[model samples]
Target: MLTNKGTLIPIGGNEDKGIEDNEQYTLEFIDDGILFHVVREAGGTDANIVVIPTASSIPVEVGENYLEAFSTLGCKNVTVLDIRSKEDSEKQASINLIKAANCIMFSGGDQSKITNKIGGTEIHDIIKYRYKNEKGFVVAGTSAGAMMMSQEMIAGGSATESFIKGAVKMYKGLGLVPGLIIDTHFIKRGRFGRISEAVAQFPQLIGIGLAEDTGMIIKNKRCRVIGSGMVIIFDGRRLKHNRHKILTEGTPMSLTGMRTHILSNSDSFHIEKKKVKILPIEAPFI
Candidate 1:
């Protein structure tokens, strides 16, 4: 399912941060930088940003980081929803915060933690509702947060180790978007093979590999790459052969004809059309 109502930003891990003079941890000082794209997508300085740190083990610390970052960005209404358990996820207060937020940002941590705690909860339902029905709403996440944005997510395993048949294990995600799987810290961690294996296994699903400091702004099933690095897309629709059906786990996989593309900043790709636009059309004549 795709919606043109809201924006979805899935950022790779290692976002900029710093420590304040007061000894409190916060994001690095910079005007309209770091999470500038996020702020802009959520209505800028006046945006009401809700930081969900459920995926992080250090929820309090991680939550504070986001709060400080958004606050420093001139977003007066910044809140951190530290959901540590399934019980906390279903709380009315939590649901209310999510419903009222202009943007919901999932912090970096364990993707499984988020799915296990918030999946199927009232808060989750509210998020889905706002994303589908409301306008100007934004959903953003980094690392594990990014991985969980799709219908199917890569739970674990590196590219090298998961090169064999059935070696890659995927888990159900938030399903904010379906028919795709996302992998973060891509190039730095050499995750191309992992995402490739995932595509080979599920040829119908598109695989996205996001490098650090890079991300994709997805709207209505169309994706635009952003940040300093690249977004690798593994399209397996032309897959000629894969012994996945007959091979067992750990067996060498034979995959062929998987088309791949590297998208840098400003590049856009249409999920349905499977086309890439390298440059934006500019206004002619002044």
Candidate 2:
């Protein structure tokens, strides 16, 4: 097994150490928003992989130069989704790409742009179909890409005590992972307050804050922390007195019984069991 502190696990290797059986969805969280990499996370060896960078604002280069590195690693075939150039003409290309691959990767860019372009289109429909019907197709993304994986996504803004009508927004995510909200660049961006704001708004949900170069892999509803930085989990299922008499901007509030855990590389935490299980440093590969 190969591990990198901040970057993604190298592509094109024929190893199945950490992947789970019957796991059709491989979700990768990139250090940067909208930027991520995914190989065949499911199915037999030599699964086809497709990359979609529709969220990017700039033009993307496809073909040899674009996919040679990963293809050389082990990916049987690689294709890019250039949805911006010819929205109508490329529709078939996008659909064909999703239909042919066992893994799909969303590139980094604006979350809104990605969702707007591919969320309800034929390509999105095909991706959803493969995720549910296919046995081993995974959907992965980086920063913005990571945010799109959750049921609720952090639209924008910084950490602070102030509030705005739509300062923090929630949208329909891809729903590959449910009940959890993901935020990247956690520590480096000082986004705790923003996450806190989200928790305050939706007390029943779990807030996952991932530091730069850090990621959490979910299996059987349990999250395993990966990479060099830390994974901050805010569990507010037991919070009390959330309702305020006069709720307003910058008002003082107290949230009691909210649970938090600081997980380092290789540490595991269970959401439903409400327990944190630390793994041995020398544990064997999965």
Candidate 3:
């Protein structure tokens, strides 16, 4: 959507839920934390928030976690829409809730479950439509949910098989951001080789590797980093002497001149411009 007016917050797994009542963690939650940003972006505490836990195997528990998290943020109008199957996505009540939502947050789980259930349904279409046409609309996701935002999604991969031809597996995603391929828990999960192979396979698309408890707020082609960890950018647009294409499956591969950028909180990446705006050392914490 060239003129899309919505916002996408794709979080890496294990974001602070503000559940700990301890003083220090609570203070962290209050001051410019990731969820705080989400609430602020979705029109404050009064925003009509819908939590979709369809991707989780334990939807009930995950849904409740979000309800509590939002409550801690002083958000009262939160509803969990547990869409377990395709039939659930077609429910009129589900559709109504989605339409009324100022923001929709998808919980972490299996990305395939979300696409299998909601990909072609009315709920999915409504989200896409509202995201493109409505200003201030927000769609947020974590882990598997984050990975589903791109057109070419990485379903699963092995970090141990570094540079191997068949190291990563790809799948069709929700197409929310067609130009990106998102991978979560990158730092902790040791997924550099996974995303590295993915970028080599599709040199045209940019690969985003989000570390746990970290995320990016993307709008108007600008991806701004947030949270406590790092975001690795693998820009394969300028790759030279690529060997992945010539190698057979399971064969070790290599590439030269594949650009990489490691960023932390407050740094911004301009998707179309292929430029990075790093935060200065003296800037105040946002």
lDDT of 1 by residue, 1-286 (tens): 4555778888876644443433224342223243888888899988889988888777887777777677767788888888888999878888888888999998777899999999888888888888887778999998888899888888887566747766577888998877678999898888877888778778888888888788778888788887877888889998998777788787877788998888888788887888887754562210
Which 10-residue window in model 3 sums to the lowest lDDT?
Answer: 22-31
lDDT of candidate 2 at residue 148, scale 0 to 100: 75
Model 3: residue 197 alpha-carbon error in angstroms: 1.0
Q: Rate the local accuracy (lDDT) of all candidates.
A: 0.80, 0.59, 0.86
Which model is ahead, 2 or 3, in terms of lDDT? 3
Candidate 3's residue-wise lDDT over 138-185, tens digit each?
A: 999988889998888998878888678998988888888888999998
**Of candidates 2 and 1, the better by lDDT:** 1
Quick one: ranking by TM-score, best first?
3, 1, 2
Worst 10 residues of 1 by lDDT: 23-32
lDDT of 1 at 154: 86
Candidate 1 Cα RMSD after full superposition onto the native fold (Å)? 3.6
For residue 33, give model 3's deviation from the true position in Å.
Answer: 1.1
- The top-ranked prediction according to lDDT is 3
User: Could you tell me the TM-score of candidate 3?
Assistant: 0.93
